[model samples]
Target: MPILRNTKKEAVIKDITVIGGGVVGASTALHLASLGYQITIVDQNNSNIAKNSEHRTGSTASLGVLMGNIFTRHKGRSWELRKRSMEIWPELIKSLSTEELPIIVNTPLVKIASSKEEMIKMENLIKQKKYLGIDFLPDNYQSLPIWIKNKYGGLISYNDGQINSLKLIDSLFLKLKSLNVNIITSKVKYIKRINDNTRIWSVILEDGKAINSHIVIICAAAESERLLQQLNYKLPLTKILGQAIKLKFKNSQVNFSGWPAIVNIKGINLIPEQPDSLLIGATLENELSPDKKYLHQMLETIREKAEWMQNYLIKEKWYGHRAKPINEPAPILKSIEKGLIINTAHYRNGVLLSPACAEWVSLEINKFHQ
Candidate 1:
């Protein structure tokens, strides 16, 4: 597609280049386009995978599924934004309609209460959060149809949704096309300014193609550092390795289980999906052997808590690095200098937090004008 031009000054942004086409990058692209910036999304997977995950195995469920996890780790603005993300999630889906909508599947969550005190804590949290405002606590346990039920009443977070990550990105990519945003299949090396009078910026690609823009945003994950390094920009970032498995429990699938997304778990989380597939995520271990026995242990850890999971057969497997941002959310979207921006380090909650983070970054990019 040709570069879109606008006669109105409000629509004039020298062009913005979003490097990395994953969740953070992809979301940034969409939001930037909405702001009327001539935007180009650069990715190695442009024509092939096009916005695939690092593990390529991300939870497509609603942000609501991870609310419990965030609550335990955050309390102030981070907590508030995460909660807001959950609220905005459904509405965003309605607007984007970019991917196949998540199926409202029942989840079979297996929660283990270590003791009476733990159970009390769980019960109290459910009440407080529920009584206070939007909470993760599910209201019903007795009405469940599945045989799997917590005798001590494991807190169930009702009304969670799930999506296929790959499909979600593709949908968003399609939506960008409708807005005339361009996505290129290549890697960005650096951002350089040319023609000072106009303040026009050019994105130099590894393949030697120079794409011009007014602003450049970095959204790539672990690779964000290397790309930035070429320009002498470094942020405290680290790569954490993650592994998971997908299983299908055909007849035993939980219909009330909205992916049975787990939260506040100590070590790992088991997120469920339609029909029989269960998404099992494990420890944030690094330098570990990829031995079959090790992978089996991760699966076993997830299956151990759920007697229901034993019925499922393995369908798919996943492994990838999640970018751990140093400091906090502010680092990724903060403006380092003129015409240069970044959006990365979303670690575990990338999918859940993508929209709000993208909106924030896009707005920051727009702020350069003001």
Candidate 2:
């Protein structure tokens, strides 16, 4: 009888609250709302859903590089998660068709080996591509761009796609609004469980307002650990700060829109954002925030390493933080207690992994009913 009561509570569960309005949180809200669950999304900044600023969130600052099979080093859980996420991209795009946002860029991905050892590894990965839909570009591959200095070798994966991260988040928000989902702008001060075993949680905001829900999912990225710590659940999540730069070619004749994203083994990448503008990024730093001096040096290093970028003009430079679980390569999805779900720590693959994580978390929550 007691178990039936819990199961009844689960089956009848209606109100769901999602903390953090990032891509993962937004996608979760969209899916849960579509499933007919009442959802309220709480975020510290409501502007994130409307316009992801370069200074605000990492998702917007990203070049939206969907590596797909090109990121062959990931295996086990990480690889599976990415593959599943890729599979859902088309469906997710169809759902956003009415929004008219830039849903996806069907572009290829090219990865260059940084060294001879890296080249060997690439060769092996290509030979062992299995069903990953990748192609090996031998050293003599003539289609290589003149600007690209691939001394080792290159591998191309044709199925990779990209999206404007900011627009994607905004589209999610629009989808949520169309579904009549409630959007609350506030910082969650603390989450209070109704009791040790009840299927309800109360999210207390910084403004002293509280919202009780049948379930609460935390997709707060870098802030997830602190919120979990407040609930006495310790998760080892590190905040890695990254900086990226946007450059436009000084000469109008240069066009990069059709170019596949060029990435090296060391993780330095150049992705085209538009015809004349290319987005080059990203130095992973141990610090939690960006230091002006260090960021300048990091950008300089990126410029020097990619000597071909010398012809481009700097448009803007920005930085954002991604969350990584200590010593863990994959994002985490776990239910600590009844109706409490943690969905965070996506690291560099947030855009690539959000869809699958959202789907996984939704299914995990639904399991309570079953």
Best by lDDT: 2
What's the TM for model 1? 0.78
| Regions more than 4 Å wrong, model 1 | 1-14, 47-70, 73-75, 98-124, 131-152, 195-199, 250-267, 288-294, 326-331
Taking the tens digit of each residue's C-alpha lDDT, what string does model 2 give over 269-358? Answer: 777777788777677888967777765675565555455555778787788888889966658888887788988888888888887787
The TM-scores, one per candidate, come to: 0.78, 0.88
**Tens digit per residue, CA lDDT, model 1, 272-296:** 5554455666546554233456567
- Each candidate: RMSD to true structure? 5.3, 4.8
lDDT of 1: 0.60
Shift of residue 207 alpha carbon in model 2, Å? 1.7
| Alpha-carbon lDDT, every model | 0.60, 0.75
Identify the runs in model 2 with alpha carbons over 4 angstroms from their true place.
Answer: 1-10, 48-54, 73-75, 138-145, 261-265, 292-307
